[model samples]
Target: MTAKRIENGLMGLAAFLLLALMAVTGIDVIGRYLFNAPLSGAFELTELLLGALVFVALPLVSRAGAHVEVDLLVSVVPRAVSRVMGRMAAIVSAVVLAFFAWRLAVLGITQVTDGARSVSMGVPLAPFAFLGALTCLVAALFGLMREMRP
Candidate 1:
């Protein structure tokens, strides 16, 4: 699939996740305060959704070059040097993210092997780890592409 198609799909998923998170939180709060009964496993659901949402958005953020940056050195250096520094930073970020993806993949495998799950909800943790790993890999690719851009 095209990059734009992938990005649009991710964006749609992120939007759905955000809406779900909001709905869950709102329902839980209303239920707790008004009915004295919070939704069961609301916290666990929120935790999982939040984790997924962040990873889902990571590639979008990377593609948009929206990551936070400290420009202290870049601000002082000459334009050419600053450009080089930016490229170097992107390369470094790609490397670090790739390493993170590898570690997450390993963790996912271990979780699957161990039959790991969330405490309250017994939700499988492997899928979340794999999602995180996949997103990090995509974000790392975006970082590498950032270095390629003029």
Candidate 2:
């Protein structure tokens, strides 16, 4: 399958997770205020879902060239110079993201070895960490693709 398709799938998952998070939070808030009882582990689940949403969407956003940027230099620079600078920026972004992914992989392994879990729900964290690392790596690849593009 193509990278664009994979990125789109990840973006869809992120969107679904975000909607789920909203629902969970709404239920928790309403239940707590109106019913005197809140959903168990709602906060922990929200935290995990938020992380998943960001990481999963990263690659799609990178691929679409939708990331926030300061384009002040682009307005003043010649077209060729601007294009060169943009490519350079993409390369730098890819390198930074790759390093971040590496660190996340190390952290995930450590979490697994240490038996880390969410405090409220005891949800295993290593899986999510590893997922984040994978997404970050994908995002880095997308950045490199953008850099290589004409």
* Best-fitting candidate, scored by lDDT: 1
What does the lDDT read for residue 17 in candidate 1? Answer: 96
Question: Which residue segments of model 1 deviate by more than 4 Å?
Answer: none
Per-residue lDDT value at 12 in model 1: 98
Q: Which pairs clash (backbone N, Cα, C closer than 3 Å) in model 1? A: none
lDDT of 2: 0.91
Each model's C-alpha lDDT?
0.92, 0.91
**Could you tell me which residue pairs clash in candidate 2?**
none
Summarize candidate 2's per-residue lDDT along 1-150 as a digit string, tens digits: 888688778977988998999999999999999999999999899999998988998998899889999999898999999989988998899889989899999999999999999998999999998988999999989988887877
| TM-score of each model, paired residue for residue | 0.94, 0.94
Question: Tens-digit lDDT track for model 1 on 1-150?
Answer: 776887899999999999999999999999999999999999999999999999999999998989998888876889999988888888898889989899999999999999999999899999999999999999988777866777
